[model samples]
Target: MVEVAMSNCANARPTRCIGVRVLGVSKSIKGNPVLDTVSADFALGRVSGIRGHNGSGKTMLLRAIAGLISVDKGSIEVFGEEVGVDGSFPMGVGFMIEPLELWDEFTGLEMLTLLSSLRGKFCVDHLRSTLIRVGLDPNDTRKIKSFSLGMRQRLNLAQALMGNPRLLLLDEPTNALDEDGQETICRILRDERDRGTTIIVVSHDREQLDRIADVQYVMSDGRIREV
Candidate 1:
């Protein structure tokens, strides 16, 4: 967890060690500005939370950090390496965004297997254990099309956690979950932080953020400020 406040230096750089750095990041969509010269630092091995009303650019910031969208100005760096310039994306990143695209024809286990194959690291046993860890039955052969919203959310989380990423970007991770499910997700997030994963979460639930976030920020009018 973040234990110290980072210094506001003359360079506008964070003094504490950082996992990711956003320097003057700005983005516009169809001529409407979404992120306006946002600057922030995410400390390594800490849980950072972003909260905001709808269309405040919380999701857009996460997307930009995840390398899913291009920024119109400034730069993003992960562990001191600039994204898109150093490489396409930061190493060991896991993310879950809305409209999760899944193969409706494939079983849940099969979907995990396919995604794991892309990384060429995890095996069948690893995938099965991840499924169970997320409270899903690995043996269930039901196609993804048959999954309910909550179940799909769990599956999405399972996939994000499959390989134990070093950086996690979760947008509304508790959405569609019951109280118990929410607790389970929170527990898993804590465990991940304990394991030194840098996590960035975007959620509307202030209580949830208070529970898990080591540092919190609020987004408004295409800008971000710590709170």
Candidate 2:
């Protein structure tokens, strides 16, 4: 269980520090308007959770922030840098979206190594510790294709947490976990906020979000409102 109450937790921080900002953002995919002038501010050094039904544009909002896809209108600013204009992807960002795609031939360690190599190298021990944090066995060498769904989810989380990224974007982070696994992940995410990391999470689990989110939002019909 999430035993740390928000008041008692060591998460004190300034209220005015904004990490990510979206303004009048609109997008259409294949003639479907997925994001309809959505806008919100995610506070720095906290976990911001967005709850929405499937295809409500929560994922699309994240993609716009991450520079994965360009939006048709409005601006997304991360740490005062405009996304898609300042750079393709914001610096020091780690994200794990759905579909959990990876090279089936590569082991967990190998896959993380390959991904991490893109930015730079992380110590082997660091990666190993990240794996352990995500409830994965650091010594496991099984290929990704052989991993169970829960295992794959854990791996995806491990990669997102690999470098102690300044910003973390996670979609349904605890998707395939058991009760214990879900608790561990929530604890990790809660602890990340303590470390001054900015996080934006999209989940269907309102209860689980309550455990970790410092602030919550509801999304409907491609619009967002604070909860």
Candidate 3:
């Protein structure tokens, strides 16, 4: 039987070190379990990596943390605040998942502009620099539909990194990148970690995970074990 915990943040208080805590989290889709009693603590100002093969519940875990999905059991707390209690995601969290759907009619710059405007944090120059940092040509006015796979991936990353989110979640962030592109992203993530950002990354690339993750976990058979 699945266990469920009522969300409560009445006593939530900022922790000096911990950024997120997952306690007995479990989820199922259409009666098939994906996450089974998963629990982990993510330290503040560090990168945590989840490595698993396809269908091992990595993405589901991330989506649950992002407040994009409801877990059938357990609790998720971000920065000491309960996730479901408020029906709103924690502030300054950014995520990039697979199957990205962009405004094909808008230019890459335009899309980023729209996102940053919603955040109300970055200016146009900052947005342009973010695009350039992700290896996209900010001056290019071509529509997103004209972009190649790798270009689109870079743009996806740009949006996630636009506002310098306090917590960043990325799944297969280097999916279509070449060696140089992958290295660039690693450097950027490392920089963000140094600046006190908490990041969670899900990837199949063991080497990349080892290089960037302060701590790592392997998910299998709907469970996660620290490595």
Cα RMSD for candidates in order: 3.6, 4.0, 7.0
User: Judged by TM-score, which candidate is best?
Assistant: 1
| lDDT of each residue in 111-210, candidate 3, tens digit only | 9888777787589899999998999999998999999888999999999897888899999999989998899899989888877788999999999998
User: Relative to the true structure, how large is the alpha-carbon lDDT of every model?
Assistant: 0.89, 0.87, 0.87
Per-residue C-alpha lDDT of model 1 across residues 21-134, encoded as one tens digit per residue: 999999999999999999999888889999999999999999999888889999999878787774497778999966679899998899999888898669899999999988
Of the two candidates 1 and 3, the one with more favorable lDDT, higher being better, is 1
Off-target runs (Cα >4 Å) in candidate 2 are 1-16
Output the number of the lDDT-best candidate.
Answer: 1
In candidate 2, what are the lDDT values of residues 1-227, reduced to their tens digit? 12233343346543346789999999998899999998898987889999999989998888888899999999998887889984577988889876667899998988888887986799888888998898888788788999988888999999989889989999999888999889889899988888888899999999989989989999988999999
Decoy 3 TM-score against native: 0.91
Of the pair 1 and 2, which is ahead by lDDT? Answer: 1
- Which parts of model 1 are misplaced by more than 4 Å? 1-16
Candidate 2 TM-score versus the reference: 0.91
